[model samples]
Target: MSDINVNHILNQMRSLSLQAAGKPVQETGGSTDFSSLLQQSLASVNETQQRAGRMVDAFESGASNISLAEVMVESQKANVSFQATLQVRNKLVEAYKDVMNMPM
Candidate 1:
């Protein structure tokens, strides 16, 4: 098999991160809500995981024409996305704690 392009994947992820960051808040007659953005992101990640699970189930049950390689790749993608989200959450929590502990 040909070698995987790590740089390409990293660049793609960086581009996506930038895009998400640069999204303008909807003018719903109010300020931007970070909670809603976080919820949307978490929902998206959950959907990805659910899709991967469905693909694996279909592949294992032989109920579809999906290949084992495709299932594995999707599974890995879901896992990596979860890990990245978890890392971001960890950093956010750490920052929150630091701020809370700062002297007033």
Candidate 2:
């Protein structure tokens, strides 16, 4: 199983967003709504975690093809991804607080 690095995927998403917001995609042109991008990322994370849960359930039920090692790895990856998402949310909240505290 090829593991996708959540941070790398998020970085690529951010780069694409910067290009989309009037910066020119490949110097062509594009735009992406930040809220939609965030929603998609959240959905992706949720889906990953769900899949990991399913894998664990299958392994626990003694599914022959599902190895314990595979289950552990998938669960760990999901946990890490969720943790990363939480960190991103924390940073965003902190930034919002900083902006709100700025004097008009």
Task: Encode model 1's per-residue lDDT on 1-104: one tens digit a residue.
Answer: 88977656655664577477565433333333679768877887898899999998998899668998899999998998799899999999999999999999
Error of 2 at 37 (Å): 0.8
lDDT of 1 at 10: 56
Candidate 2 wrong stretches, greater than 4 Å:
1-28
TM-score for each prediction?
Answer: 0.70, 0.73
Tell me how candidate 2 scores on lDDT.
0.80
By summed lDDT, the worst window of 10 consecutive residues in model 1 runs over 23-32
Candidate 1 deviant stretches above 4 angstroms:
1-31
Give the whole-model CA lDDT for all candidates, comma-separated: 0.80, 0.80
